[model samples]
Target: MNNLGRNLALWVSIIVMLLLLVDVFQPGNTQHAAQQLAYSDFITDVDTGRVRSVVMQNQNVSGTLTDGTAFETFAPQDPSLVSRLTGKGVEVVAKPLDQEGSPLLRYFLNALPIILMVGIWLFMMRQMQGGGGRGAMGFGKSRAKMLTEKQGRVTFEDVAGIDEAKGELQEIVDFLKDPQKFTRLGGKIPKGVLLVGPPGTGKTLLARAIAGEANVPFFTISGSDFVEMFVGVGASRVRDMFEQGKKAAPCIIFIDEIDAVGRHRGAGLGGGNDEREQTLNQMLVEMDGFESNEGVILIAATNRPDVLDPALLRPGRFDRQVVVSNPDVGGREKILRVHMRKVPLASDVDPRIIARGTPGFSGADLANLVNEAALAAARLGKRTVSMREFEDAKDKVLMGAERRSLVMNEEEKKRTAYHEAGHAITAVLVPESEPIHKATIIPRGRALGMVMRLPEGDRLSMSKKNCIAHLVVAMGGRVAEEVVYGKDNICNGAMGDIQMATRVARSMVTEWGMSDKVGMIAYANDDQGGGGMFFGGAAKNFSEHTAMEIDSEIKRLIDEAYDQARNYLHDHVDELHRLAEALLEYETLSGEDIRQIMRGQPIERVEVDETTPVNRRSSVPQVSGPEIVQPGDKPENDKDEGGEVHPVPQPG
Candidate 1:
């Protein structure tokens, strides 16, 4: 029922109950007095001898004659006058009792029901408001949800994009399913498996899938949930959580964002007494305290493994650490297909193509892309999601949602068009760079324009030439602005691009053995000391003079690459102008359109200089300076270092 109708019904029921209670408790004598007052005048007119039966109006009064002289003059005592007859001629005698109780006692006894109803209402209100220590006392109860195998919906089939991680975790499921198999082989099962990766990589999802596959109970909670304002609450929760998990043995405890409570103690300004530290200490103790016989396994996920405590990561605690990273092309395709199952997709909508377009997308990103595509189709009142919708959805996901209402002046639009076109042309022409996916003059997120490129596949090792090409592509937009609109038109739009290029250049010189002067040495900093502090040894591969020479060489390389791009665009100015104009008109253009304008055909093959060896490619002939190094030979400084130079390994 509606609220008003329910309230009215409650009011009516209460009123009826009150009236019935009043009737049951009302004094009978008081009502009898009311009736006698209506017949007072009639009884006074009755003669003594003829009044054998006296009728006073509609009520009958019967009495036995106590004296015979009452025939001459008869006077009935007034019900209100009975108390005033105390000092009169006759003495009144007591009458025998006919009923058992007084009316006053019955009235109070019947009011008991109303008192009970009031007591119940007060109790319920106190509980709901968390008053009277009713609901408030339950605050320390565990928030971890216990999910049985029948209740779990996620299995191995539901998760994608991390096959290696899955394989590692699958062993844990096997151990949980059949512990004796490992014991017979003299193998001890790992107590805990830490899933470490960036956010949105499906770490928590994998844990759930493991529980579902093993058909075991799953207890899921966040790391922060164990902490509370009280000092000892966190420790208490950790104890209780483990105690519960032990009872439900052969279960998995999935803690997401474990970094919240598992950070290194005393690392923060907040001392060891901090609640989070207390919680972490308790967790360490609990994890270590358990015997190998206990089947309860702990699964924790975190994006920041570096910040975790060393004690917690020692062998018996977190025995295995699985890194779940962004999906590769094949993995991305699998993730996309898994997400696309719920979407009403057209026949032409290919998950492989979508996956190829997104190089760094996580599993969450793929799911969001599919959801966005479905939303786009629904907005247009379409039955199925098409390729165009998916493309738009991808743009929306990577960038921000479309801002059609974000109007810009004509000059700004032109600048954005040229900027995007510059990136596209440069990336397309550069041999070591990936192919351009899309270039848009439309404002997306904080960018005035954007250019997107998809890597051919995941790269584990990047060559020096490939690194330089990437830097050149990054600087293309600024170079285009300088070449076309002069240096005066350069803006802050290239800040991210500049930072990226600088990092790549630094990596080349220090780590990749790309520089001739700073040959076969690494000066890269490991920023895990505290708050990303850089700490490392210096590069002894070069002298002060050689350092200056290296700096000059890097600048000259960037300057030459910029000039090459500018000259190429200058020779094909008409094509550049056409592409820019098309971008301004359409707001977005594909790589094929830009390719057609440049070469009048699609790209056949991206050239790779195989004639030059990988180590010698950086020493190619240039405008000035002596050749620094030869192929398969260390520099003179290598002997100074007391050994032959070998290439430093690249960062993983």
Candidate 2:
């Protein structure tokens, strides 16, 4: 198009130049030349009648002679006179002399160039506005990219970690490939399939694979592309998109993030006149208007299918909604392997280990893992990616890279080490708690230290006791600091821990029905309504007396758990100090190192003096009675009597 415009401008300029040259060189008047030569000879032959007659003959031939004028009937006798008369009698009309052409014709000719230029300008503008041929100016054409079999090379094998979703979509591919096989048995292919899951689960990749497998045209676009600033542009775009799909029959239209446009109508504050509602209405109409067995299929993907309108998920529209969730260990392994193929890996690098390390990674996460590993190896100037590099890469992906530049003073470092060691020791001591896999005092991301624990397995159900045990483990760090380093060392490190513990405790007391005072009274809403309030009620179902009792019970549970952690650490102070020192040296400690320390030394049993009063000897009541005698199985506190001691349960 640019070249065409340039060529047209050049041709117009050339035509104007040619017209100027013609006007400059061409003769304006030839008749005036003859009259000048004739007058010169006529003066020499003034007395000769022969000359007069010659002049008359010349005038008659030139149509300038009067009927009464004497003229030569035959040829002139005098040669010079004859020549002069022949030229004189022919009168040349006075020629209008001007260098330039006529004003009207000149203006028309000059303006012709400007007119032609303007015409070409308008043509270019029209081409640009109309998509060069596709449609009108500013028309909302769907920006969906079409991929044909020739350009699409992805297959089912190319995508990983979404097998179930792929399996559901595979039927669509089969229909496209062999429609007759199903049609002969009176089986009708579904009009649409909705890939529903969180982001980065390979929903779009599966769509491409289908396109490649079926060797058909694939039109891919986002749900937002259907919306426009104009009120009806979205609906117009939807109509145009379906029309194009119909032209390319046996094709797939993949709409990514369909919830953007398919959000439930009349749910928001905006009423029926909403622009998005109009677009969604048009989409629903188009979906229902299409025949089921027309060979054209619609495949849409959304992370938030919950927000989409129910009409879009009806039988005639999207009948099947496949969930593309985070991959399991096996799926992770496959996804890792698929990504690993692209990187130069060491012989010792095992993707299974990487897969096991990342439990909740999706296909996109695995791909990023591979890219990060490559980058790590590149930074190290290594030829092949090793297991250590992959591990570093995984850590970098999960939490950010270790910030060596995040400087800390000796006091801060020691505090962080003790805090992390406390969490690890508590996790190891508590039977219901998950095992601590790694504990590090190194500053990574915003955390001064972190203790990573591994669950026994993926848990879909959790008990009240389990929740309380987890909270105890979370609170152990601050509790340990208070018992050993005194309350002064406890900083903002426990904010997140306290928040998580409080939430768990609330869940146990109100929702899980674990509290004795508020048993089975679920104050939490099932839906966890979108608003900030957890539940709509201003007060609990129980009376004020019961509420006080519930509050007291909750505080007692938390205090008991904190005191238990403190006692455990106080008994093993030497080991705790040793672990903290080791952590300071290495910046990290494994679970095995922690277990070895606990096994090497035993805690000394504290003996009470008979001289001390029974009531003053213990703070916690024994047997839930007035007596203050220490429980038989309770670990004695080595600290002051002001310190609490958890009543250790008796073994069966």
Candidate 3:
């Protein structure tokens, strides 16, 4: 029934019940207010012929007095009593005890409780089944959403970046719309296409766009929907999903995060006899069984293609593997512009500069960057998102939120300035290192100082020279600490720097084959293992002595990089001191400022009083003359008293 009719029926039934209660009980408000009389007086009145009329039912009696007032009292349920009332010259009558409503209400009230209970039971059943009458069964039904024509609003124009992957899928979209174009030529279209990429690279968005372009029914589901706790439920779901797709005929079934169920069986628990495996087996059967699934294009996305079952990737199944990698610089610019279209951005906010600054950002990351910039602008009570806010947002995304509330002592601040100055100076001196983008002494995230380097362009691969130069620049912080504060007074500011340098050294020795002892061979677990990507796969194939040689080689590389850093800093001590002083005075410096300083003047090797600058510059730097060490030579007067240029302990 409609809601209003149902409600009206309910209220009418309730009113009928209330009326029945009133008719049966006959509340005192509807009875006459009469003078009190004893049973003997009632009998006297009845016998004296003073009563006009009387009625009796069971043990109750009702009569009207001579004055036309009605009265009621208890009496025996007897026919004799009524006869006596009739013979006393009084009119007698029966009460007929029926209520004043229609008889249908009686029947409806009796059946109303049953109807309400049945309706509630049905509602609970439908809820447990899933929803509506269609889900009246258990969880065997497919959960794939079937979007009809014009349902999905996302088109190809909405997605930017990952053009190669888009190009690969465009043909799939075309085939979905006109399948006979390829079928008449005996060319079988691929039933399944796998989109492989990292998270947030628009894999799912691209799938939706394809659905929009095809103008057909779109079925979207995740792989987890196929797997259930029950043994056969998953397999039944898979069959049902395929059945749905087939009924929809010209439809696109996009399975997101297919890896959840597509993992390699027998690799983990249950020994390939789990519900997921059964689901996968049923999926394989329905996908490429005896009958060909025509016009039901299946597309799935995953980040980890390594663990997928081989059967899922075979020729007739997932024939095409389109990789949706992070976009390059140009693609990033396009994505930024696409996201910025909705927000009011200032003219100074150039997508090119933002893209250049963000080299490794995916499409989602760029979108988030734009959102963060807008949020920053809004937080500052600004209407337009400016480049300054974008830059700050990028810094926040990369380094972390600014720790403006953190307080630092003067000594700590001075140490942070020198540490940052060392990084900037090394970056400027080292030829292979990328240019220093910005240097700051203000605390951000967990670091006390920061030196951000922006590469001229994205580097797909790093050279060994560049790697070593990075190491040298990384050690510059500790190198300066040792140069100014002496080895005993160096703090733990270079803990992160040391860790990065060690990792590079290890990678060079184990994976990159840069170690002299390792030759042109990779000893990494990735190169040797049949093991999983996450779980440490295999032990390196080498003797204990060879392992010792590898460790020694790593230490030696670090030592050499550190020596190079120390030599560079020793020669440019005057520049290092000036830069540190400038940093102390400004508390920050931009890339342009560093470049200007580098181009402005060469620092003369002249001594200054420790108390002269008031910026707390270290007093250890002294140059005898203008002569300094070249690339292959070492300084003469910087060695220790032992006359041995031994390896020094880096900070932390």
Q: Which candidate number maximizes TM-score?
A: 3
Q: What is the TM-score of each candidate against the true structure?
A: 0.66, 0.71, 0.74
lDDT of 2 by residue, 416-447 (tens): 87887777778888888655556677666666
Counting clashing residue pairs in each candidate, in order, gives 0, 2, 0
What stretches of model 3 exceed 4 Å from their correct place? 1-134, 148-152, 271-273, 525-540, 601-652
Which portions of model 1 miss their true places by more than 4 Å?
Answer: 1-141, 149-152, 268-275, 290-293, 409-411, 482-503, 506-513, 517-554, 601-652
Q: Residue pairs in steric clash, candidate 1?
A: none
Q: What is each predicted model's overall lDDT from 0 to 1?
A: 0.67, 0.66, 0.73
Error of 3 at 13 (Å): 22
**TM-score (C-alpha, index-matched) for candidate 1:** 0.66
Report the candidate with higher TM-score, 2 versus 3.
3
TM-score rank order = 3, 2, 1
- For 1-652, candidate 1 gives per-residue lDDT tens digits of 4545766787678767776767856675343222222233423323232222221221233332333212222235556432332223232343443567886576556766775786687576555433424233334555678877564389999998799999999898898899898999899888899999988989988999999888888999998787766677678778878877988998998898998889878877645459888888888888887454288799999999988999999999999999999887788879987887766666556676676666567888888888888898889897777666777887777666656677888987787777667777777778876666666776666667777665555555667666666666766777767777899867766666665655557777766778887677664443333333322353243456755766676676666667777766666667677787887776765666567657655323222232332231132122111211111111011010001111222344
Candidate 1: count the clashes: 0
Better of 1 and 3 by TM-score: 3
C-alpha lDDT of candidate 1 relative to the true structure: 0.67
Q: What is the Å distance of residue 634 in model 2 from its true position? A: 36
Could you give me the TM-score of model 3 versus the true structure? 0.74
Poorest 10 consecutive residues of model 3 by lDDT? 628-637
